[model samples]
Target: MRILVAPDKFAGTLSAVEAADAIAEGWSRTDPEADVVTVPMADGGPGFIEVLHASLGGELLAVTVRGPLGDPVPAAVLKVGETAYIESAQACGLVFLPTEADGRTPRPGVAAQASTYGVGELIAAAIDAGARRVVIGLGGSGTNDAGAGMLAALGASSEPVKAMTSGPEGLAHVASVDVEPARERLAGVELVAASDVDNPLLGLRGATNVFGEQKGFVGDDAKLAADAALTTFAEAAGRKVADAKGAGAAGGLGYGILLVGGRREPGFATVAAAVGLPDLVATSDVVVTGEGKLDWQSMNGKVPVGVAGLAGSALRPCIAMAGAVQVGNRELRANGIEAAYSLVDIVGTEESFAHPARSLAAVAERVAKTWSRR
Candidate 1:
C-alpha cells in the first residue's frame, strides 16, 4: 500500500516534517512493505517556511526584524524566481511573542502589546532582494492593531498608534493614516495575502470580537474599543475596508494589504497549487493529513481539510490525525475526510504533549492495523 503522510505542525510539540516522519515510521512498523511518501504541509501559518522551502526549492534569506513585542527576532523570506513568499508568523506570529525564559511556552499579556511591524520590515527585505511579486502568509498573528504597526513600518507618515500596548485600545485614538509613501515603495510589486480566514474587519463576527481573545484581547470592552479604533483607521484609509472579505485575517493584515492595492487569495489552495499538491494526490494511493488541533476551525479552509478535499477530488481515501480531534464523523465526512484519529487518545493526554512523536507513531501503527483489517 502507498500512503502519503502530510501534516501541519502540532503546535508546541511537532513540526509538519517531524509528524510525517513519525507517522511513516510507525506505519512502517505495521507494514514493512508499505510505500510511504512524506510531504509536510502548512495552512499559511507557522509551518509555511519549511513547506515552501521543501517544495519550491527557494533561496531562504534571513533578516533581523522586530518581534511582536518590539524585541529582535530572526525571520526569513523565501524567493523562488521573481516571487517572494513571506510567512507572517515569522514576524507577527504568537510563536515569537514573549515567552517564559525557557522559550518553550507562551507568556500572557504580550499579546495585548504585540505588533506586526517586523512583518513590514521583512516585506521591505523581500522587495530589496528584487522580488517583483510578494505572497504573504497570514496566520498565527499576535497583534490586534488592524495591521497599524505594519502600516507604520511600510512608510505611513502618521505615528503608529502604538507598537506596544495593553490590547488594541490605542487604535481608538487613530485619527488619520497615510499610505502614499507605502504605495510608492511597493510601486511595481504585486502583493497578495494568502489567508484562510474570511472574517470582516469589525463586528460581532469580525476580527476583534471573534479572534481577539485568542490573541489576548481580554474583555468585551477591549474588543469594542479595538473595533471602534479599526473603524477610525478604515475611514482614514479612505475606504470602507472593514467589511471586506478576509479583512480580518492576521488581525487585519489582509485588509492592510488591500489598503495598499494587494489582493486576497485562499491560503491552502494557493499554496497547494504552488506545490503541485493535486498531482501528488493523484500519484498516491492513500493520503494522510492533519494539524495541531482538529476542531471546527479545521473545516474552515485549514491545511488538513484542504488536503482532504484534494484527495477526495482525486478519488483517494484520506485519513487525518491531530493532537486532538474535537470534530465528529459527520463533519469530517462532509469535508471529505475518510477517517480521523488523535494522538491524545493513543498516548493519554499528558504523553501527547510531552512526547508527541512517540504517541503519533503509536497512533499511526494502530491506524495501519485497523486499515489492514479492512
Candidate 2:
C-alpha cells in the first residue's frame, strides 16, 4: 500500500517536517510493510519555505530581521534559482507576538504595538541576493497596521509621516506615502504576496474586524479606530484598496503589497505546483493530510483540504488527522476528507499536546491498521 503522509505544523508543538516524521513513525508501527510517502505541507505561513525546500531543493539564506515586537529575530529567505521566497511569518509571525517576552504577566497591551517592519527587511535581503522575483508567504501575522510597518522597513519615509504611534491606531496619521525608495531597491524585481484568504482589507470580513481579536485589538472602539485609520491611510496613498481580494491578508499586508504593485496569488496553488502534488497524488492509494486544528477554516484552502482536493480528483481516499476536531463528519466529507481523527479524542487534550509525536504516531498507526491493507 502507498500512503502519502503530509501534515502542516501542529501550531507550537511540531513543525511540518516533524509532524510528517511522527506520522510516518506511527504508520511504520501498524503497517511496517506499507509504503508511505512523507511530504510536509504549508499554506504560506511559518513553514512555507521549509516545506517547499523539502520537496523542491532550494538554498535557505538566513538573515537577522526585526521580530513583531521589534526584537531581532533570525529569519530565512529561500532561494530557488533567480526567485527568492520570503515567508512573512518569519519576520512578523504571531509566534513572535510579544507576551511574557515583553516582560509582562498575562501579556498586556502588546498586540497593537507589533509591526511588519522585519518582513520588509527580509524582502530587502531577497533583493540584495540578486533575486529578480520575490514570493512573500503572507499569513500568521502579528500586526493590524495594514503593512505600514513593512513599508517603513522598506524605506517609506517616516520623516514626512508624523503621528507615528505604530499599529492600526496611527495608520491614519501617516502623512506621506513613498514607494520610490523601495521601487529603486526593487528594480527589475516582481513582488508577489501569496495568500489563501480572499477577504478584503476593510469591513466585517476585513483584517481588523476578522483577525484583530487574536492580536489583542478587541471591542467595538478599537475596531472602529483601526478601520478609520486604515481608511485614512488608503486616502493618503491615493488608492482605495480595502475591498480588493486578499487585501485583508496578514493584517492588510496584502493591501500594502498591492499598493506597491505586488500581485496576490493563491498560496496553496503556488506551493502545490512547485511540489508537483498532483502527479504525486495520482500514484497514491491513500492520501493522509492534516494540520493542528480542523474547523470551518479548513474548507478555505488550508493545506490538508488542498491536499485532499487533489487526492479526491484522482479518485483516492483522503484522511485527516489533527490535534483537535471542531467540525462534523459530514463537513469533513464535503471537504474531501473521507475520514477524520483527532489527538484530543484518542488521548486527553493534555497528553495529546504534551506528546504530539507519540499521539500522532498512535493515530497514524490506527489508520494504517484499518485502511492501509484495504
Candidate 3:
C-alpha cells in the first residue's frame, strides 16, 4: 500500500519534517514492505521557510535582524529567482522569547510598539539584492503593532522612529508615517502576504479578540491595544483597516503589508499548490496529515482540513495523527478524516511529550499495525 506521511510542526517540539520522519521510522517496524512517502507541511507559520525552501529550490540567506523585544537575532529568507520567501516567525516569533526571564516573565504583547520593522528590513534587503517579488509568510508573530515597525524600517515614518522598538505602547507614540524612502527602494516589487487565518483588523472577532490571549493579553489590554493600533493605522493610511478579513493575522502584520502594496492569499492553498499536494494525492492509497492540536478551528482553513478536502476529491482516505485532539470523533469524521488519533490520549500529555520522538514513533507504529490488519 502507498501511504503518504504528512504532518505539521508539533509546536514547541518537533518540526513537520522531523515529525514525518519519526512517523515513517515507526511505520517501518510495523510493515517493512509498506511504501511510505513523506511530505512535511506548514500553515504559513513557524515551518514556513523550510517548507517553501523544500518546495521551491532556493538558497537560504541568513541575516541579523531585530527580534520581538528589539534584541539582535538570526533570521533567514529564501531566495528564489526574483521572488524571495520571507517567514515573519524568524524575527518576531514567540519561540524567540525565553519562557522564564528574570523575575518577571516577558509576554507577547498587543500594540503597535511591537512592530514588524525587522520583517521590513528583511524585505528591504531582498529588494536591495534585486528581488522583484516578495512572498511573506505571516504566522507565529508575537506582536500586535499595525506594521508600524515594518513601515519604520522601510523609511515610512509615522512619528519619529523610536530607537527602542519593544511593545504596543511604544508603537502608539508614533504620530505620522512617511513611505517615500521605501517607495523609492521598492518601487516595482510585488508583495504577497501568505496568511493562515481569516480574521479582520478590528472588532470583537478581530485580531486582539481572536488571538490576543494566545499572545498574553488579559482583561481589557488586548481590546485597548487593538483599538489604539487600528485608530493609528486608519489615520495614517486614510483607509479603514477594521473589518478587513485576515487583517488581524501575524500580529497585524497582515494589515501592515496591505498598507505597503502587499496582497493577502490563503496560506494553505499557496503551499499546497507549491508542493503539488493534489497531484501526490491522486496516486496515494492513504494520506495522513495532522498538526499540534485539532479542534473546531482546524476545520476553518487549517492545513489538515485543506489536505482532507484534496484527499476527498481524489477519492483517497485521510487520517490524522495529532499531538492533542480536542474535537470529537464525529466531528472529525464529518470533516473527511476517516480516523483521528492523539498522542496525548494514548500515553498521557505529560509523558507523551516528554520525548516527542518516542511518542510519535509509538503512535505511528500503532497506526501502521491497525492499517495492516484492515
The top-ranked prediction according to lDDT is 2
The lDDT-based order of candidates, best leading, equals 2, 1, 3
Better of 1 and 3 by lDDT: 1
Q: Write the per-residue lDDT of candidate 3 for residues 1-374, one digit (tens) a residue.
A: 88888788887789888888888898888988888888888878889989777667788888888887777889887898888888898878766654445423445443334557788889987887778998888898877776667767787655546721445676455566676666666689999889877788776777777777666665686567656766665566545554577787887778877776678899888788878889988888889988888888898888888889889999999999888998988888888888988999887799777998789888998988887543
Would you estimate the TM-scores of all the predictions? Answer: 0.92, 0.93, 0.91
Model 1 lDDT on a 0 to 1 scale = 0.82
Quantify all predictions' global Cα lDDT against the true fold.
0.82, 0.83, 0.77
Model 2, range 72-151, lDDT digits (tens) per residue? 99999999999999999888887776556553222434666677888889999998888999999988887777787787
Off by over 4 Å in 2: 100-108, 158-165
Clashes (N, CA, C under 3 Å) per candidate:
0, 0, 12
Question: Which pairs clash in model 2?
Answer: none
Instruction: Give the lDDT of residue 141 in candidate 2.
Output: 84
Angstrom error at residue 308, model 3: 0.8
Worst 10 residues of 3 by lDDT: 103-112
